[model samples]
Target: KINKGGQLSMKESGEKDKNECHGGDSRFMAMTLKRGRKKKALEYLLKKEESTVKAMVDLKKKYA
Candidate 1:
Protein backbone atom coordinates (compact mmCIF):
# COMPACT_ATOMS: atom_id res chain seq x y z
CA LYS A 1 0.00 0.00 0.00
CA ILE A 2 1.02 3.61 -0.46
CA ASN A 3 1.36 5.88 2.51
CA LYS A 4 0.53 9.59 2.82
CA GLY A 5 3.91 10.56 1.38
CA GLY A 6 3.40 8.24 -1.60
CA GLN A 7 5.89 5.75 -0.25
CA LEU A 8 5.07 2.06 -0.23
CA SER A 9 4.02 0.57 3.06
CA MET A 10 3.29 -2.91 4.28
CA LYS A 11 0.21 -3.17 6.43
CA GLU A 12 -0.76 -6.34 8.17
CA SER A 13 -3.66 -8.16 6.56
CA GLY A 14 -3.72 -11.03 9.11
CA GLU A 15 -3.31 -13.54 6.31
CA LYS A 16 -0.66 -15.71 7.85
CA ASP A 17 -0.21 -17.92 4.80
CA LYS A 18 0.13 -15.16 2.26
CA ASN A 19 3.34 -13.41 1.34
CA GLU A 20 1.34 -10.33 0.33
CA CYS A 21 0.76 -9.71 4.01
CA HIS A 22 3.78 -7.91 5.42
CA GLY A 23 3.57 -9.99 8.58
CA GLY A 24 4.41 -13.25 6.88
CA ASP A 25 6.78 -15.73 8.51
CA SER A 26 9.58 -14.80 6.13
CA ARG A 27 9.88 -11.42 7.81
CA PHE A 28 10.92 -9.77 4.58
CA MET A 29 9.67 -6.39 3.36
CA ALA A 30 10.38 -4.71 0.04
CA MET A 31 10.82 -1.04 -0.83
CA THR A 32 12.39 1.18 -3.46
CA LEU A 33 14.77 4.06 -2.89
CA LYS A 34 17.26 6.14 -4.78
CA ARG A 35 20.84 4.95 -5.13
CA GLY A 36 22.21 7.63 -2.79
CA ARG A 37 19.74 6.73 -0.12
CA LYS A 38 20.71 3.07 -0.39
CA LYS A 39 24.37 3.90 0.02
CA LYS A 40 23.62 6.13 2.98
CA ALA A 41 21.68 3.33 4.61
CA LEU A 42 24.57 0.95 4.21
CA GLU A 43 26.90 3.51 5.77
CA TYR A 44 24.51 4.08 8.62
CA LEU A 45 24.26 0.40 9.39
CA LEU A 46 28.02 0.03 9.33
CA LYS A 47 28.67 3.07 11.48
CA LYS A 48 26.05 2.11 14.01
CA GLU A 49 27.12 -1.54 13.98
CA GLU A 50 23.46 -2.56 14.07
CA SER A 51 23.02 -5.38 11.61
CA THR A 52 20.76 -7.70 13.54
CA VAL A 53 17.46 -8.64 11.95
CA LYS A 54 15.59 -6.08 14.01
CA ALA A 55 18.22 -3.41 13.52
CA MET A 56 18.08 -3.84 9.75
CA VAL A 57 14.38 -3.06 9.95
CA ASP A 58 15.05 0.07 11.96
CA LEU A 59 17.58 1.09 9.36
CA LYS A 60 15.04 0.67 6.62
CA LYS A 61 12.61 2.98 8.39
CA LYS A 62 15.29 5.49 9.18
CA TYR A 63 16.39 5.64 5.58
CA ALA A 64 12.90 5.54 4.21
Candidate 2:
Protein backbone atom coordinates (compact mmCIF):
# COMPACT_ATOMS: atom_id res chain seq x y z
CA LYS A 1 0.00 0.00 0.00
CA ILE A 2 1.05 3.58 -0.57
CA ASN A 3 1.15 6.31 2.06
CA LYS A 4 -1.14 9.35 1.99
CA GLY A 5 1.73 11.22 0.39
CA GLY A 6 1.61 8.67 -2.46
CA GLN A 7 5.02 7.28 -1.56
CA LEU A 8 5.66 3.59 -1.16
CA SER A 9 6.79 2.37 2.27
CA MET A 10 10.42 1.41 2.48
CA LYS A 11 9.36 -2.07 3.56
CA GLU A 12 7.66 -2.60 0.19
CA SER A 13 10.13 -4.29 -2.11
CA GLY A 14 10.32 -5.93 -5.54
CA GLU A 15 10.71 -9.40 -4.00
CA LYS A 16 7.03 -9.54 -3.05
CA ASP A 17 6.00 -7.71 -6.20
CA LYS A 18 7.60 -10.36 -8.40
CA ASN A 19 5.62 -13.10 -6.64
CA GLU A 20 2.21 -11.42 -7.23
CA CYS A 21 2.18 -11.11 -11.09
CA HIS A 22 3.36 -14.70 -11.55
CA GLY A 23 0.80 -16.11 -13.98
CA GLY A 24 2.54 -19.48 -13.70
CA ASP A 25 5.04 -20.93 -16.18
CA SER A 26 4.53 -20.89 -19.96
CA ARG A 27 3.11 -24.43 -20.04
CA PHE A 28 0.33 -23.38 -17.65
CA MET A 29 -0.55 -20.39 -19.81
CA ALA A 30 -0.80 -22.45 -22.98
CA MET A 31 -4.32 -22.63 -24.38
CA THR A 32 -5.95 -25.32 -26.53
CA LEU A 33 -8.56 -22.96 -27.99
CA LYS A 34 -8.60 -22.23 -31.69
CA ARG A 35 -7.55 -18.70 -32.55
CA GLY A 36 -10.03 -15.96 -33.57
CA ARG A 37 -13.22 -17.53 -32.28
CA LYS A 38 -16.14 -15.03 -32.44
CA LYS A 39 -18.18 -16.04 -29.37
CA LYS A 40 -21.31 -17.17 -31.26
CA ALA A 41 -22.58 -18.94 -28.13
CA LEU A 42 -22.82 -15.70 -26.19
CA GLU A 43 -24.56 -14.01 -29.10
CA TYR A 44 -27.09 -16.81 -29.24
CA LEU A 45 -27.81 -16.55 -25.54
CA LEU A 46 -28.35 -12.81 -25.75
CA LYS A 47 -30.75 -13.24 -28.64
CA LYS A 48 -32.64 -15.86 -26.64
CA GLU A 49 -33.02 -13.49 -23.67
CA GLU A 50 -34.21 -10.62 -25.88
CA SER A 51 -36.80 -12.76 -27.64
CA THR A 52 -38.12 -14.08 -24.35
CA VAL A 53 -38.65 -10.59 -22.93
CA LYS A 54 -40.37 -9.35 -26.11
CA ALA A 55 -42.58 -12.41 -26.07
CA MET A 56 -43.50 -11.93 -22.42
CA VAL A 57 -44.43 -8.29 -23.01
CA ASP A 58 -46.60 -9.20 -25.99
CA LEU A 59 -48.37 -11.94 -24.00
CA LYS A 60 -48.99 -9.59 -21.08
CA LYS A 61 -50.52 -6.99 -23.39
CA LYS A 62 -52.71 -9.55 -25.14
CA TYR A 63 -53.94 -11.51 -22.08
CA ALA A 64 -53.68 -9.24 -19.04
- TM-score of each predicted structure versus truth: 0.26, 0.24
**Candidate 1 Cα errors over 4 Å, as ranges:** 1-36, 51-54, 58-64
Tens-digit lDDT track for model 2 on 12-39?
Answer: 4535332123431111112111222225
Computed on alpha carbons, the lDDT of every model, listed in order, comes to: 0.40, 0.30
Model 1 C-alpha RMSD to native: 11.6
TM-score of model number 2: 0.24
> How would you encode candidate 1's per-residue C-alpha lDDT over 1-64 as one tens digit per residue?
4333332333446333343354321133224223445664455445332324354555367646
Which residue segments of model 2 deviate by more than 4 Å? 1-48
TM-score of 1: 0.26
Cα shift from native, residue 8, model 2 (Å): 56
